[model samples]
Target chain A: MASFKQIHKEFVAALLVPSAPIPKGLVALKKPNITSRFAVYRNNVIVGLIAALKSNFPICFALVGDEFFKALAVDFIRKNPPTSPMLFEYGDEFAFFISQYSPADQLPYLADIARLEIMWRNAYHAIDAKPLDIAKIQQIDAKEHSNLTFKTHPSAAILKSNWPIYSIWQGHEDNDMVDIDLEVKQAILICRPNVDVLIANIDPAACIFYSAIMNGRTLGNAYEKAIKQDQNFDFNYCFGQLFALGLITDIAAEN
Target chain B: MSNFRLKKIPNLAGVGLKAQHYKTILQEKPKLGWFEVHPENYMGAGGPPHKYLTAIRELYPISLHGVGMSLGGPSERLDPEHLRLFKALKDRYEPWLISEHLAWSTHEGKFFNDLLPLPYTEETLNHLANHVDEMQSYMGKQVLIENPSAYLAYESSPYAETEFLDQLVKRTGCGLLLDVNNIFVSANNQGYDAYDYLDAYPVEHVEEIHLGGHSVELIEDDDLGIGKLLIDDHSSAVIDDVWDIYKKLIAKTGPKPSLIEWDGDIPEWPVLFNEAKIADGFMKKHVSTKVKS
Candidate 1:
């Protein structure tokens, strides 16, 4: 008789990887063969994990359809089982999965869409915080304003995708936008300063600036990054838009 | 958790809350005992899940049923991160009841996402009791451990299913959430009488009851396929046999807080409520008022 630890080790292997026999001493079912009965547990675990993936990656599921997505989910789950009890926490690496998956290579943008969805979920569950208003920005010391590095809201995410990820996600979510111009760069901004998960398609240059600022660069350096991305980058317009959208929550001025 | 109890639940039939019915439930606010949620679903920071749950929780007494605690995890330890989230939720919600499965869903570093079975032995029982005690102490509230539906039983098992639960209850002071459908399904798969198992059940320790649907599969090898295999999928309406078993227990124990769990192929609000009404019909038939509430 295998110890409980050995049985679990073997059982988990059978559940994930193929070709391992069920652990020993399973009560002999005279009628139903142990293989078929045991498959129920196998089926249940796989099906449940797949469902969690499906829930987290609905847009990916919709793009690929049911059968294809289920197969993809099964493959992903075997390689990357969840480490947390929270089902929502599963599938964090799915976007990368799609990127490397040979079958999904045809749709390169599929991975970015998964990234966007996961970010949306992150924003949805982010810690509740009051975003910085115009008053707080105006209160900054005038001399140190240029050295300000903004603190990102816990729910804020700035995704810079060369692929038109925003339009692709928007098309499926709201509009039936099928024939999108793939050449157009979609710099997407996601934030939940309040209850709703907000998504915006911002200028690529502004996203570069926002990313730098969120990454702890001073406003001066961030502006340079933005200008490098787009020489025509409008600092006032972009910063105004970001502040108005509540993406820039807290600002720290450097000495 | 607050030392002050919020409110008490009636020994009435309730249905597991699904997000699809959120709008209908908020608008209708139907007559139900209380709502139960897999706390994992709302583990996210803030969003529609919390919003809708808050709306419903305001109108009804909520119960938090954890699916991923892996209380009986092979490591014989609970995940600190999971425990932190569970504790945070317990503080915020102060639900009428908090519960987890007797089964383990994790091993080593990987989580399986299903209620995996455990061996019946002194070592296993001691570990489980310690885990349950830690969980209850951490939460500062009585936690109910649920009986799981087993696909196969181990031959090395020393104690009967009911006796194991009884001993665990005595050791940890944790109450039992007797899942009637699990009893029926496990009894069928293990070749035992569901009624007899319920009769031997520690009725005094049962805090809640669960009724769900199970389907039987023909033994693949049998040429006649006369041999049956029961699968507790929790899909569709609760069947007559499970209902009968539930009634038999209720007759002996009187009214207890019961829930109808239809996780698979979840139906609309009316269909689910109707299932609860069926369980309610059984509850009304057997016992009049609450006894072991």
Candidate 2:
């Protein structure tokens, strides 16, 4: 007789690994056919997990087609089942898995696309915060602004990749861009200032500054890093773009 | 305990509130008893789920059905984090009724999100009862434990499924949610008396009823195409057999709050709304029959 703990371990093992036989002592003695019946449980588990991934990564699903995507998702699920019940946070590691996935290597840019989708989901579900009043930033004296530190929106993220992921993302939205220039590098600033999630293409300098503030660095230090990344980095232009997007929710200045 | 007596739900039928149907539900204001949502769907930070749910909730009563609680987890401790999320949703919505499956979806720090059946044994019964008791207490309200649609029965199980549920009721003072579709599907797959399972059920304590669709698949290479298995895929309209069983249960137990659940391949608003109306029609017919008798 299997203990509850033992049975669950075996059952989960059997569920994830399709080739593994059903857990011992799980067969119905009265019923003649148990394997096919057991397969139903496997089908339900795999199908349900696949559906979650499919919804999360529609672009990936479309690019790979349904059959290939299901197979890919099944492999990922077998390796990494969810730790928490909240499914919105379930696929955070999927993009990482896709990057390392051996079979998906042919389409090198597929993993970055998955990353963008995950970022969109994160922004969609992040804590709602009121964007800082623009008037306050407008009134900041020249010297005071230099030492100021700002807190980025709870859901703000910067995804920098060598592939043109934004164009790939746009192609999926029915505005099909026939030819994607994959050689060019791209960086997207993801934020949900209001109801709709917003994404803006930014330069490497802006990515450097965004990463600095997200790491709780002072504006003065972030500007130094941004300038180091790009000699032509315009603090005013980058700041203006971020302010317009409502990516910065709060700020503090050392008087 | 909000009275162990069943909570009085409107004697009308309802449907699972899906996001696609939100706009039309608010615009048309479909005649629904109450709309149910999986609390997990609303757990997101902000946006449309709140916007439309707020509008629709005002017009119709709401019920919270949970899919990820892991009530009967192998570990003694209930997942505190999930409970916290659940508590927040309950405080916000104040749904008419909240229910979770009797089975566990999480174990050993991993979750499957599918309702996995349990062996009917004394150890399993006691563990589940304690979990339910703790859950109801933590929620500051009683919860109805829904019986799962079983795929395979354990031969080593000492107690019958009904007896195990009855024990939980006796020990923890929780209510039951009878999924009629589940009953039919499980009976057909496991080769049991569907009505007999219902007869042995604690129907008096059944606070709610659920009706959904299922598909039949023939098992291969077993006694030369000897058996058929029914999968409870809630994607299609309610089948005739499930309707017959639901009507029989309604006739026996009288009218209760029923929900038309079309989880997958959800049809347009009118079709799903009509299914709810059909359920309501059955309830009205049962009432008229009682008056004639």
Candidate 3:
């Protein structure tokens, strides 16, 4: 009788790699063809995992097309099987995997596009938070403005990329008519107003400002850094846009 | 009155709640007996998943069906994070029943994202039963263990599938979800008698049931195409054969909360609800017969 550990190892190995030789211990007298039988099970296992990945990363699959993506997914699954049983939570490092993959390297922006998809997914699933009320903003004294710390909405995401990720994503969307240019650099803000996740482009200065706020910087310091990056940085326009987008959810004076 | 009282799930038919129908289900307030969601989908702190689930919970009983527990693994250690999330979900939703699959999904800390089959033996049963006991203890509630739909079975299993299930329930006091489609799929794949398997099942421990659609693939060997056997793909409409088996099981087990699950290639709301309606009709018929008798 094979030991339980040996049989399990063999079973998992067989599920991942069909051609791998089954560990010597897992033998049953009636069914000597354990190899072929397990192969069928292995196929089902891979197919299921691949389908889950496809669902979780539909835009990534759409970019590469099904045939190539499925092949790539098979490779990705073998290399990095999920760390959690929840299929939705699987593929955390898929974008990073595409970044390092040789075949995917030619599409230099694929990784960033994958990141945008991840951000959209995160925004879609992030916790609901009440947007900053204009009434609350009126309560802050002009003297305390410099000491006020702004907190980004729980669902706020800032993504910067050289490629037009928003256009790329919109181009592949169902019933979308926008033409996409793969070469243009794009900076995007993804946030949820109500239940709908909205993605919009912003200048690099605003991206930096929001990134600083997200990193727990005070509004005054964030503005100073934005001004340093771009002398023409329009604080009024940027702040107004952020507020209008419902990005800032909480404000506190630095203690 | 304590609002946290464990609401007993009605012995009627329900449907797996999906994001696509969240608004409609909440707004229309369909008369669903219960709703089941994959707990992992709502593991995040605050999100649409939680918001919708909270709204829906007020109207119908909920069950947390976990897909990631990997109970059949050789290791004695269960994932603490998974346990924490399950605890959080239970606290938030106060689900009527919590359940996991009878298969292992992870090994050596890597999840395959599929419910892999287990060899039914003394060692395997002991490993799984211990995990079930641990999960029950951690959650402070009994869990329903569902049978996995396997494409192949290992010859090493000494115990029959039903017997293995019976022993697990006996050892852990856990209930069974008794997925009828999984029974049909496994029996077809292993060339076992499906009805005999059902007949041998300990129906008293079955707390809920699942009915789902499957796809059939024809196997060819030596230039001969054999009769088709089904695979539990959860991608199609529930077939007549599976429904027939479901009717039989409901007739025997009496009315229990049944869920119409269509996870892949999901149809429109009405089509999916029609499937639930079929199961609901059967449950109602059983109820009327019981009262008449």
Q: Per-prediction count of colliding residue pairs?
A: 1, 0, 3
How well does candidate 1 reproduce the true complex, by DockQ?
A: 0.58
DockQ-based CAPRI category assigned to the predicted complex of candidate 2 = medium
DockQ of each: 0.58, 0.51, 0.47
| True-structure RMSD, every candidate | 3.2, 3.4, 2.8
Using TM-score, rank the candidates from best to worst. Answer: 3, 2, 1
- Please tell me which predicted candidate would have the highest DockQ against the true structure: 1
Off by over 4 Å in 3: A22-37, A173-183, B1-5, B221-225, B290-293
Ten contiguous residues minimizing lDDT sum, candidate 1 chain B: B1-10
State residue A180's C-alpha deviation in candidate 1, in Å: 1.8
Give one digit per residue, the lDDT tens place, for model 1 in B137-239. Answer: 8888999999999978777889877899999999989999999999988888877888889889898998899999988787755433557778888887888
Residue lDDT tens for model 3, A1-255: 666666677778777887787655333223434454455567777888888888888888877888989888998899988887666667778889999989987788888877887888788778788888766877877777767787778888888888887777777776463566766888999998567787878788888888887788888898999999999999988878767888888885553
Q: Candidate 2: where is the Cα deviation over 4 Å?
A: A24-30, A133-149, A175-177, A212-237, B1-9, B221-224
Interface RMSD of 1: 2.2
Deviation in Å, model 2, residue B59 alpha carbon: 3.2
